[model samples]
Target: MTMLTIDNLVKTYAGEASRRAKSRSGTDRTAVANAAPARVFAVNDVSLEVGDGEMFTLLGPSGCGKTTTLRSVAGLERPDSGRIAVGERILFDGDGSRTTNVPANQRGLGMVFQSYAIWPHMTVFDNVAFPLQVRKRSARPGKREIQERVAKVLETMELGHLADRQATKLSGGQQQRLALARAIVIEPPLMLLDEPLSNLDAKLRESLRYELKRLQRELGITSIYVTHDQIEALALSTTIAVMKEGNVLQTGRPREVYERPNCRFVAEFIGTSNFLRGTVASREGDLVDVDTDAGRIRLESPVRVPVGEEVIAAVRPECFEISRTGWGNRPNEWSGTVTNRAFLGDAVDHIVRVGQGSIRVRGNPAISIEPGTEVHLATDPAKVTLVPVG
Candidate 1:
């Protein structure tokens, strides 16, 4: 069953207009520009369904509406249009003229912010217990129950030793763990994280990524995370929605989005891709021949490209093989000079200058190759992808 559903969400802000005039070549030119805008859409017609116990992520650059979408789902921001449903309850519905705006307090959601929002004056025990106390009112948990719950959550988060310490005295990682514990103490049905690890150091963030995923799985709570970090999104999310300028460009599993991008924007945004432009010369079954400045190449793409039509093919950096031997029976082969080389621990990156452009190739670090040397690069035809133009 789906835990959450968002349909055609929209948010906008408004602005004013100004005019400017310029003269060039004895001719007068006028331009009208809006000074900001009153109704600037932060999120535009976005829709998604997250399954129960699934980890869904809204991954994009800042100002792409990822955080705005998250905020809208949490009831912190009301959308200008559309509907949001949690389980069987309709949180917000703009259609059918039905308007229901559930308050954030009433929504069963646990939110962990980027900043460790633990109170400096409070002890770790009090911080984690605050939610339970607030919810239970006069019938708060007994001392034994509180202690047991706190101890269990702390142990799960690996911060049991710091339970007695003040929140301010703990390290950045410990504070983050405390924040997470506080959120999970109430055991909300849905979890929302907004760049929770952005404030931590690089090494700490790297280590915490695994811990966060494990905790989320163990708790079995449906989660929606917002972040601009590509590596974090790729490593943590079961499905990723790549957004830009208030619109979702693509939504799919990480591997699907990376391996077979539907458009040029998705191809460039997800990872490094070498784009080759050419005209379709011939087609046979799943194979299509493209005529380029360097030579004619055969690619295995399901997309049917009409003859004489211009198309762009994308190949990942790690997909090509660099070697001194000539292309024996490989379908796609190109000869180029290595313009630059860089060793990146596990792999070596090479910039090969082919016809009109240079392409990046990644190979094993142990494979020795130097700049200014001519090398033959071969790739399986089946690996090449033909994506529609943006």
Candidate 2:
């Protein structure tokens, strides 16, 4: 079953024009001359469908409207246009004919903000029980029921020992866990997390990401996560929607998005890639011959390009092989000078200069290539992708 559906959503803010105008000014010109435009498209014509028990992620850079789209679904921000449906309920419809606009509290959605949002004065138990206590007096659970429910959720979140401790006294990771407990205590059908781990340190964030995904799977809760971190999105989500300037450029499984990107923007945003600009010289079944400044090469491409049309080809850093011998007998190979080398713990990154552009290649440091050394690099033609450049 599709748990949530967001269709043609749009959000425009009045403060964007002012920010853009300020960005275009020179350092010496301190005085502002004119008022900026009044409209900014925070989320523009975005649509998505999330399946039940699936972890969906809105992944992008900052100011890409990932958070805004999440907020609109939470009913915290009303869309200027679009329809939002959760299960069989219509939450927001812009046509005015549908009178249903469920308030956030009544929407049965759990939210975990980046700041944790736990009360410092309350114990973990109280924080988790607060949601149940806020409902109408008649609907409130009895004391015994509340205690059992609170304990159950705390145990599930692995915060049972900290249940008696004040939220303020817990560690950053514990506090984040407490926040999750609080949000899930209500048993909402959908959970919305907005950069929930951004406040934590890098190591802690990395550890908690796995824990969070495990917990979500155990509970079988449909969740929508928003983050600017590509790694987090890739590691945690069943599907990721890549956004740019209020538009959703692509949405697919992590491997699909990474291996078969729809455009240059998506290919560059999701991870590191070496882009080669070229023109299509010829075409065969799944392969296309690309002519670049450095040399002519044949690459496997699912995307078609007419002969003589300009295109950009992208290959991931880890996909290339660095060897002392030239592509003696291989079809797709390039020779270039090693411009820079960085020794990453697991793999060394090499910047190979080809013609006027540099392509990053990742390999073991044991290969023995030094900066300024001429080297030959080869990549499987089947792995190369030709993307249309706009």
Candidate 3:
């Protein structure tokens, strides 16, 4: 079932004009008065659907409009145009003839923001039960029911033991979980998590990240998560929408987006990649052959690039096999001198210079080679990815 649908959701902000702009040559008093300020389309023609019980993530760097899109869905930011619906409930419809919009509170969504918004004066138990206590009398649960619900939610969040403790007394990670506990107690149809783990330390973030995933799985809640961290998105998302400059560039499974990016932006953004300028040599079924300055390489790709077309061959450092001896008669085998080496505890990174190009190869720690040593590099055809040129 489609739990959430957003169609042509657009949000824009007018650019702030400078006070000195009125004195500029082209902008006289009349020109300044009549001029229409520039508009920044924060979310431009954004449309997507989230399946029931799916953890869909909106991923992008800062200022990419991901947060804006999430806020629009939460009814916190009113979009300039478009329609947003959760299941059959029309939360927002910006059509001129007929207008329909449900306020944020009436939408009944569970939201955990970046900040841990726990009440300082309240105890953990009261914090979780407040949402229920504040409900309208007819809709509110009885005192006994609220206590049972809050207790279960606290235990699920692993904060039950600290229920009587003041909210300010808990640690950072605990406070964050308390915020989530409060949200989950409501049992809302959808959950909106905006960088919930961003403020924690690295280790705590990783631990809470897996815990969040486990809770989401156990509860089976449909969620829309927004984050800029690549690893976090890959670790937790069922689907990821890569956004840039107020538009969604691509959406796919974690491994699909990482291993086979359709464009250069996706390839470079998802992970580190060595881009080799090349031209298509030939096409055979699902395979494509390209000739680069380093050597001839083959890639397994569904994207069709005509022969003789200029393209880029992208490969991850770990995908390349680095050896001291040459593997004769194999395609994509190149000999180069190791320019530098870095020993990362579990893996070793080697930078090799081959025909005016530097190819980075990462391998097991046992394969570390010193600078100035000769090395041979080879990779499987399926490992190479063909990315479209600008």
Candidate 4:
């Protein structure tokens, strides 16, 4: 079931007064006799649908419009044009002659921002119960109900024992939980999280990541998260939308996006890959043969290209199997010298230089190869991915 829908969402900002007006395309057009200032599109024609009970993440670098899209859905920023809906209720629709926009306070969405935003003067219990206490007179819950709801939410967040403590007196992680507890008390239809872990230390952030996922599944609340951290998105999201420069480049399940990226940017952004620029040498069903400076490599890819078409073959470091002896006549086998090596505690990485390009291979620490040693690398065809060149 669809929980949230956004269509043709576009947001733009006007520059400072009276400098020469820039065009919408960002081209330095010659100033007309009298023209309006140029408009910069923060989010350009973005559309996406998020399913119920799925943790959807909008992932991209800064200035890529992930936050703008999230804010628009939260009714925090009014878009220049777009429609935002949850389940059948239209929170924002700018399509018709009469536009409909619901205010943020009325949207009833639970949101956790980068900052905890805890009320220092209030106790943890009061912070979570405040939402219930401030509802319209007829909608407000009774004292007993409010107290019970707050207590339940605090316990779920593992902060029940600190309920009487001042909100600011808790640790950073606890404050984050307090913010989440407050949001959960309302039982919102959808939750919007914007880099909610960015402010915490690495250890706390990682610990909270698993905790948040467990809590979400327990509550079964649909959530839309925005973040630039690729690992965080991969670890926590069920679906991911990769965005770039105000446009969504691709959307898919976390594994699909990571293993089979649609474009070069997606492959480069989602994770590290050894990109071997080559041309399609041959094709037989899903198995493709590419000729590169390193060698003629074979890959199992869903994308089919014409013979002699320019392409880039990408493979993850962990996908390659490295050994001291050559695998006799393997489909994707190449011999190279290990020019560099690194010990990463649990895994070892070796930089092997073949003809002109180098491929990084990572594996269990037991397979570490010495520098200057001749090593043979081979990968499963199914693990090699093909990327179309721009």
lDDT of 2 by residue, 239-272 (tens): 9999999999999999999988889999988888
User: Per-prediction RMSD in angstroms?
Assistant: 5.0, 4.4, 2.1, 3.2
Candidate 1 lDDT over 270-323, as tens digits, reads 878988888899999999988776567778888877999998878899999998
Q: Which order, best to worst by lDDT?
A: 4, 3, 2, 1
Ranking by TM-score: 3, 4, 2, 1
Supply the TM-score for candidate 2.
0.92
Q: Write the per-residue lDDT of candidate 3 for residues 1-390, one digit (tens) a residue.
A: 999999999999875563455557753857877877667889999999999999999999998999999998898999989999999999999976877778988999999999988899999999999999999999999999999999999999999999999999999999999999999999999999999999999999999989989998999999999999999999999999999999999999999899888788888888789999989999999888898888788888888889999999999999999889889977788899999999989999999998879998988998878899998899988888888899
lDDT per residue (tens digit) for residues 85-204 in model 4: 999999999989999999999999999989988889999998999999999999999999998999899889999999999998999999999999998999999999999999999999
Superposed by TM-score, candidate 3 places the C-alpha of residue 238 at a distance from the truth, in angstroms, of: 0.6
Compare candidates 2 and 3 on lDDT and give the better one: 3
Clashing pairs in 3: none
Report the candidate with higher lDDT, 2 versus 4: 4
In model 3, which range of ten residues has the least summed lDDT?
Answer: 18-27
For model 1, what is the alpha-carbon lDDT of residue 42? Answer: 94
On the 0 to 100 scale, the lDDT of residue 227 in model 4 is 97
lDDT measured at residue 252 in model 3 versus the true structure, 0 to 100: 91
Model 3 gets an lDDT of 0.91
Which candidate achieves the best lDDT against the true structure? 4
Clashing pairs in 2: none
**Candidate 1 least-lDDT 10 residues:** 16-25
